[model samples]
Target: MMTVTDLDCLRGQRRVLSGVSFALDAGDCLILRGPNGAGKTTLLRTLAGLSPAPRGALSTAPEDLVYTGHLDAVKPQLTVAENLTFWQGIYQNAPQDTLNSFDLDELADRPAATLSAGQKRRLGLARLHVSGRKIWLLDEPTTALDADHVARFTDTLQAHCNGGGIAIISTHLDIALPQARTLNVADFAARQDRTADEEADPFLQGAY
Candidate 1:
């Protein structure tokens, strides 16, 4: 199980989240929902250990966590299959059905550089299957995906959760995941003095 206590995150010098707490066990999915600039990505980064929590207790091994950021970490010079193979080598375990899961079987041999934005995103998502990690931290994973691709990705996430894998995703789109807990990052925003104009747009309170 992964546990968090009073996690506070900052973007540059501006404090974003304060007094945030949560616990996640196997087969659990947690979704972070908020408008852009609400620090959803920041919180995910903090959880992934890419950034410090400042003040919090996070229980999880860095190796056990697989983090997929907003950007597709695909190498333009590599082929789609090569990319998956690279991760497979790192994890030393890869799901046999990973190719079909993300509908990339036909594109397996294609160079990642030739793939479109959505296809590159699919390849990025396919890496999760080969990660062999207990926990997944995804930030806006549905980017560049069409409706059908989104549903496909959601199904993959659902299966992972059903198989006792943990997933924490930051996304604005409704993924319809089973038994997933939603976290509103805006609720944990730090209370501080801001100009009246800044206060008017509540969504602008936190930096992305």
Candidate 2:
């Protein structure tokens, strides 16, 4: 289980989130919906332990965490399999056959830089299957994916949740996600006494 207690976030001198709190149990898949600057990524970063501590408490299995952001975070020069192998050494220890689940076996020997944008998105997503983590934090996961890859991603997400894994995704495109918890940034801002676009920053790149 993942517990987030009264989390607060600061970007520069601005308070991005104040008294932000939530809990994620196994089987929980939360989707964050906000305008351009709603602080979704800030929240994700905080949850991933990459940001400054918030005002509240967070008690979770730190090691059981997997975070993938807008950036691919993969070595551009490395082969697909080599990249996976490197991440496996640091992030997971899944069976070798798990690569087949993502239909990446054929591309294993290919250089990561040579993959198409959609292919890279698929490659990024393939990490979730191999990762033995309990919690997944994804930001705009469908960034460069096409219809087929998106469908595959949705199925993969369903399987992960079915297997007791929790995921938090922030995206612009809406697809049917089973049993998901949707938190609107508009509502969040209203409660926080801010304007509609005030809290939704992801849509606006300069905010980041």
Candidate 3:
């Protein structure tokens, strides 16, 4: 189980998050929603361990977290399969044909930079298949994805949750995540704004 105590974040002069608290047990999904600069990305980065914890709340085991952002985190030069291999080396060994399961078999040899946005996202999603980590942090996960890929992502996420994995996704899309709780960060932090240097909230500006 992963527990996030209170997360206090300051972006520049603004306090993006103050005493923000939430808990996610095993197999739970938390959907993060907010406006353009509601600190949604900042929170995701903190969860990813890519950004520093400012104050109050948020304690976690770094090894247990998995993060995927809008950038896809792919090596433009590496082929589809190579990227998976690299990730497998970092995470745990993946199940057989994990790429195939995501309908990426045909493009396994294609360079990640050459694929469309949706395909790249799938490759990023495939990492969860073998990551073995229980916590997931995804940002803008559904951007540029077609219906089929979205369905696949939802299915895999549901399976992961069923198997005791928890996920926190930041997206504008409204997919049917029955058990998922959608929280709007904008509602909580829209009253304030700040710069990264001021509060050192790097994730607020795609630090990771």
**Considering every candidate listed, which one attains the maximal TM-score?**
1
Residue 97 error, candidate 2, Å: 3.7
Worst 10 residues of 2 by lDDT: 185-194
Using all chains and alpha carbons, the TM-scores for the candidates as numbered come to: 0.90, 0.85, 0.85
Tens-place lDDT per residue, model 3, 1-208, is: 6667667665654567666678878878899887787899888887787777677655678888888887877888999999999988988676786877788989989999899988888888888777888888888887878998888889888988998889999988876778899877765562444565746765565432
What tens digits encode model 2's per-residue C-alpha lDDT throughout 1-208? 8777777776555667777667778899999888888888887887888888637788886788889998877677988888888878877475576566666789989999999887787788777766778789999999988787788788878888988999999988885776898866444331335555856766664443
Compared with the true structure, model 1 gives a TM-score of 0.90
**lDDT-based ranking, best first?**
1, 3, 2
Q: Write the per-residue lDDT of candidate 1 for residues 1-208, one digit (tens) a residue.
A: 9999999998878888898899999999999988788889889889888888789888888998999997888988999999999989988997899999999999999999999999999999988889988899999899999999999999999988888999999987887976898999999987777787877887887833
Pairs clashing within candidate 3? 5-57, 5-58, 6-56, 6-57, 12-195, 12-198, 12-199
The 0-to-1 C-alpha lDDT of every candidate, in the order given, reads: 0.90, 0.78, 0.80
Model 3, residue 15: displacement in angstroms? 2.6
